[model samples]
Target: MEYQYPFSYDWTTQEIIDVIKFFEAVETVYEKGMNRDEFMTFYRRFKEIVPSKAEEKKYCNEFADSSGYSPYHVVKKMKESNPGDFVKMES
Candidate 1:
């Protein structure tokens, strides 16, 4: 909960905020539950900011190292879920 999020210096302030929001939504998926639509909204914006697969993996791996939550898992679950479903990770 007290870890720094992975971010790029090249990004604008709003882009950084959007990236953090997406990471927080990933956290929410593990901590409680998030609506699929809402989580995807965050993910979509995140993709806009981090378009490269390598870059996304780097950021997500850093986040997992710091926060102990896996963005990969959340996205995997998201892929398996329907629009109205709630995406949650079991502890």
Candidate 2:
């Protein structure tokens, strides 16, 4: 909440919103919990906006540094979980 979401100046308004939603979903995993399907939906949109793995790592690392939530870990859990399962993170 104290830090802004990492984004690109070239992105469209909707793309920026979608990226924020994706970060919010990551935050939700640490704060409460998010369903795997819902998280994946946002994540898919995020990947569409930032298709590069290096860029994804940069943004995710920035967010994690500011918020203490790791998008990578949540995503790893999502990949390991079945659909409808809730993803949550502690740390």
Candidate 1, which ten residues in sequence have the lowest lDDT sum?
82-91
| Candidate 2 C-alpha lDDT tens digits along 1-91 | 6888999999999999999999999989989999999999999999999999999999999999998899999999999999999878886
Reference-based lDDT, residue 40, model 1: 95
TM-score of each: 0.97, 0.96
Off by over 4 Å in 2: none
What does candidate 1's lDDT look like per residue over 41-62, in tens digits? 9999999999999999999999
Candidate 1 structure lDDT: 0.95
Cα deviation of 45, candidate 2, in Å: 0.3
Q: Superposing all C-alpha atoms, what RMSD in Å does each candidate have to the true structure?
A: 0.6, 0.8
Clashing pairs in 1: none
Q: What is the lDDT of residue 13 in candidate 1?
A: 100
Question: What is the TM-score of candidate 2?
Answer: 0.96
